[model samples]
Target chain A: MARVVFTANLHRHIDCPLQTAPGRSVRAVLEHVFAAQPRLRSYILDDQDRVRKHVAIYVNGERITDRERLSDWIDDDDELFVFQALSGG
Target chain B: MSDRLLVGTKKGLFELRRNHADWSIAASHFLGDPISMLLADPRDGTLYAAEALGHFGVKLQRSRDDGKSWQEIPAPAFPKSDTDGLSVSYLFCLETAGADRPGWLWCGTIPGALFLSKDHGESWTLNQALWDLPERKDWMGGGFDDAGVASICVDPRNSTQVTIGVSTGGVWRSGDDGASWHAASEGMHAEYYPPPRNHAPEVQDIHRLVQCPAAPDSLWVQHHNGVFRSTDGARSWQEVTTIRPAKFGFAAAVHPHDPDTAWFVPGVKDECRLPVDARLAVARTRDGARSFEVLTKGLPQQHAYDLVYRHALSVDATGTRLAMGSTTGHLWITEDGGDAWSLEAGHMPPISCVRFG
Candidate 1:
């Protein structure tokens, strides 16, 4: 089983809550997280279920770019961190 | 009753409706000037619009009974001497003072002007107090244009406590119904000022202001650089959110009931037109300003360059419905508290501004 954590630097605040779930692949892991917190899903994915261009996610410190490839194999001890990638002038 | 959507295009005002199963454009004979704002008042089902004509300047128009007919309001003229022979920009916001204070319409303008309409959309009077503020001199030295006044909120219960966003001028509060005002930009992010340090410029260029009706002093301001919350009227404010996106977009709508619930759209850089490759979406903050969530469901993925200016976002009186119009000519409506959204219009013209009816 893989574990996932969610954090954001929202509204000038930081280090809030870290969402955790148990699953074998990224898709299964995200589905579990969405089932528990639906509101966060919209911020994480686009209308086509792809990771928003502004959002970034890392699986066990390794950045994951494909939204559909969430079903990739993962270790039970692996962790995930998702956040908005800040960019601008 | 038919649901009508009045949209402004590069060509004039376009009235539209989703008939049966088809979304058809009703009329497009307004002459093609870009529309700056569109408002549908719910109290009486009236529609108002602001259009920006090249060289001719900004103009205001209205339609009583939903978008079936239209007429222009005489543009408030400034003495040729004071205006430098230039006309003021079109109205950006039209807010009624509610049923108890009928016929009280307040409009915010570009370049930071505030006008009051006591007779629906008829005659207009500029709030000299806001127009001639001592800080006006320091607030006008920002980016491109002075931005403008984009947000205005009137306390439904105590019309005395009114708040307005002066583009890059931060936020200003008036406890006596626009009679006099005070700067509420303390601690806000004002980037256009002298130096782009911490939060100085923010107190100057506020893009949106949403005052909590229950707690009149508690307000939320969306600035060009960050978001702020003031719990003690205008005395102080706390930094809530900051966006360093590929670009910048204006507009902030607060939930009618939950002061903690609000929404804003952050586009690419302030100098750019596209939304980081045309992927525009709205961000949500549920716990007042503690955190934010981006809502992309039902929104376009590719070529999504909709720019939602201030006042383009609105929530029904119930606060249960959330709606925002985009510059890409689309309106996204959410009835289930923004957990999900439905596309109301796909292509209208880049929507300049939107108000709920």
Candidate 2:
């Protein structure tokens, strides 16, 4: 099981409590999370399933590079943080 | 129907309710969020709000109980594609299809895209026919990087027939429910562009488009070049250069049941986008733009530098109530059409759009 946490700013709009889901890869883990909270997909990704320009995701405190594939492997105790990148004036 | 006004602003959404001759703020939601578009469905009385967040992107919220509570829903997004570099900047317009299509909703957005939802805005799909047009390659945004669909007018007589106005992209009409599209800006001119390009069919900059419900065939447009009206279903337009002060404006409100009556707030040319002579007034034409009467009752007439956006002026279904908001954070209402106006609210965030619910 991987632990997933959302930014406080996103919590202001939707109730995205800490989620724990079982998966081998980041993509599979996020797929399970998004299935429960579908509205978060539009804010995090664009039409092509690519990570949105201002959205950032990190696996074990390191930024994920494969935004399109999102195939990075994850361990049972690893943590994922999804946050909106600081943007605009 | 109870009188209410939904005001979208750069900061949040403000709801105003009428009490006798004056209007007061009823509720305010989405504080500190940039509200771009708002609409109230006549069929179910559902209120939809579009917000653009700098970090999170575009979002849609819906309320069924007159905005007392809201729920965020999945918004329209471009399909992931390698070559597509488009992202929704903001939603420009929200409209219901008609009485026949109960749960249908139309959304026009920045980057010049049209989306339709059959399940009341829970999900949306892009109109690929309009997006795939060859002319779209040249559609540039007037204010931003890409053109935006500023207005959408669906024919009440035929829900399949739709007219869309795009900034810097001209007008497009679809007679088969957006299956196909064609340029309908024949006589509309774009004086800002050089010769030949100025008269091109798809180069006109349309600020707003409004159609009279009583006569669906009659359409009024506030073009960046001037003000125009088309009697043959937007197939052609004739500039109404006779409008007093100047025809350069962003907003136009049409009477609900009168085809010949409409109102506009005229500002100076693009160089100076303020009211003529620094006097804020609503210019109305009852005889189809033949002449104009400036209504200034209870409005600022001296040193006022307010500009109304394309969706900031609205007329209710009965054509008796009117509400308008300004970029300077001033709101005004008229219970008896455009005959008289009174300040409803002031000193708030800059208003983006206004709708009477």
Candidate 3:
């Protein structure tokens, strides 16, 4: 299982506990996690389900490029990171 | 007079209580979060606060038992079919339907959309009529990069007769409780545009629109270039050309009972938002703009760079008490109708809106 880590700042507002989720794609992993932890979707995505402009995601220590589709490829043992964009917070 | 005040600021929500002549900061909530708008719903004493979290998104919470406890409510958002790629950028205004209609609320937002909730803000839906208006295509932002619905006035005589002010979009009125709408700023003009386009009712930049509660037909507007008054229930407007200390301002408040009486914080418009001659002043009209008075009783007269936002100047229901907050984080309360004033807080986050309950 791959682990997903959220910024400490986000924890200040809502709790997104550290956990491992299943998936080989960023979107699928997020969907798997969002199903268990609700209201977290709104903070990471917008009305159109696109990654929020101020939120950045990473897979295996590399920043995801497809923010809208969140189609970044991932490996089974890779880690996912969610963070507020540098210029945002 | 109001004994309680709710001041939403750039970083938190500050609650002040008044005991006789003294005011104290009783509590603070959502600290370190930008509070964009607030409504201490006079109809039910239910308080709603709009938190604008840029990194995440806009969030909403309501407190029924004062500030003791609050429940997070869903913030208004654009539907997936937003062809223009529109999303709620900010929650600009929140207003009740009327005293007769309980649990009904109206919310205005940036990118210029109006929302409504019939269940005490438990949920909200975009007002389709105003959102889909063809004239909205002409609307653009003022100082903000995107236009917004900044003011909403539900007629006291009839809640169905709703009037709203868009930052770069002109005044709109709905005769059927948000089911339908039309441009109501007929005589209102915009100096930002040229010749014929300046007269277009759709692009007038109304800084704020306020209705006198006792005289529902009388409306006052603080515009981008000057001030305007409407006596025919917002169907038509007439410019007030006599205001001094520079006619440009963002905030306007009217006396609850006297339609002829109103207050404004005048300053230089556009990029230069400083007080004229660096002297903070409140311009008041007691005779329907026939004449004006610049009141600076306790406000800074030297090196005063305070600029009051549209929702920052609030007049309580009694018409005698007024609370004014500025971009410089200065909050002042006037007990004698602008004849005198006193600073309550000199250091705090820049205030976005101030409301009395």
DockQ for every model comes to: 0.01, 0.53, 0.74
* Candidate 1 lDDT over residue span B45-154, tens digit each: 66777766543345677788566677767444332343223235555666776556766777877666788887777777778898778777656523436556777777
lDDT of 2 by residue, B30-52 (tens): 99899999998989989999998
Clashes (N, CA, C under 3 Å) per candidate: 25, 5, 0
Among the numbered candidates, top lDDT falls to: 3
> Which of 2 and 3 is the better model by TM-score?
3
In the range B160-214, model 3's lDDT, one tens digit per residue, is 9899999999999999998989889899888878988898988899899999999
Q: lDDT tens digits, residues A1-89, model 2?
A: 99999899888877789989889888888889889988777777776777778889999999998887788888998898999888653
RMSD of every candidate to native, in Å, equals 23.2, 2.2, 1.3
* Candidate achieving higher TM-score, 1 or 3: 3
Q: What DockQ class does candidate 2 belong to?
A: medium
How do all models score by TM-score? 0.69, 0.93, 0.97
Clashes of 2: 5
Query: What's the best-to-worst order under TM-score?
Result: 3, 2, 1
* lDDT, residue B229, model 2: 96
The DockQ assigned to candidate 2 is 0.53
Ranking by lDDT: 3, 2, 1
Per-residue accuracy of model 1 over A21-81 as CA lDDT, tens digit each:
7887777788887787654554465434556556677887888856544556666778887
Cα TM-score of candidate 3: 0.97
DockQ: which candidate is best? 3
Candidate 3 chain B: minimum summed lDDT over ten consecutive residues — where? Answer: B80-89
